[model samples]
Target: MMQLKWEKEGYIVSDDKTLLQMGKIEAWISGAYWAAGRSREIIEKSIQHSLCFGMYDKDGRQIGFARVITDQAVFSWIMDVIIDQEFRGKGLGKKLVECIISHPDIVHTKMGLATKDAHGLYRQFDFEMDECMRRPLL
Candidate 1:
């Protein structure tokens, strides 16, 4: 997949996986409710197989992150969306999701995501709860 980027208000969101800081991402995501106890190996594999977004500040510090599992044709499911706690309430999350959903390869695909609390945020992007069944193995 072609790497893509979006910039706004001095913050940048990029899909270049090489630009990701694994250590920081692992730390932030490991503390998240959905991904707590997730190991680096799994995270690394996820990034390798999925389309990942990393949001950075003017100085290039990563401030937010998200990834999408997609076929680039019919379906896209977003996961592990998170912003550094220090940067929340600044609209960075909105920008990050904007970049993801607006991405060229994903724009036309049906998108889905699971969020424990950020419903207001995703709803802004037209994401809504729908009837879908899942089988959990965890």
Candidate 2:
């Protein structure tokens, strides 16, 4: 399991699935525009298949989350990044993403993500807009 700590702030970013709080994760994604109406079953399945990251404060309460679908070699697509409402604007989201991209398993892969309005955030990590296309399954 990969773990990174912000010693000064007592915040941790880890890839330990056992530390993930499913209810909180489901609620966060269910409320997001891109994943609104997503079922808990689907969320669980996605987390099972993806490399997951969970962020927690000193008290071990989950406050943010993200996941990556990757081959761990060539490509990594980051998804479901959210910072708990109360923790927003504190730079925790940025730190979560930093830990994800810097993880040894996927750091060298080309990273990608689709965001409705977080272009600025992703740009800070050197993710650039590209001519890419996607197809919505019927």
TM-score of each: 0.96, 0.95
- Ten residues in a row with the worst lDDT in model 2? 1-10
TM-score of 2: 0.95
- Which portions of model 1 miss their true places by more than 4 Å? none
Tens digits of per-residue lDDT, candidate 1, 1-138, equal: 667888778999999998999999999988999999999999999999999999999999998899999999999999999999999998888888888998998999999999889999988887878988999968
Please report how far candidate 1 places residue 85 from its true position, in Å. 0.6
Best prediction by TM-score: 1
The C-alpha stretches of model 2 lying farther than 4 A from their native spots are: 1-8
Tens digit per residue, CA lDDT, model 2, 19-104: 99999999999999999999999999999999999999899999999999999889999999999999999999889988998998
Q: Candidate 1's C-alpha lDDT?
A: 0.92
Highest lDDT model number = 1
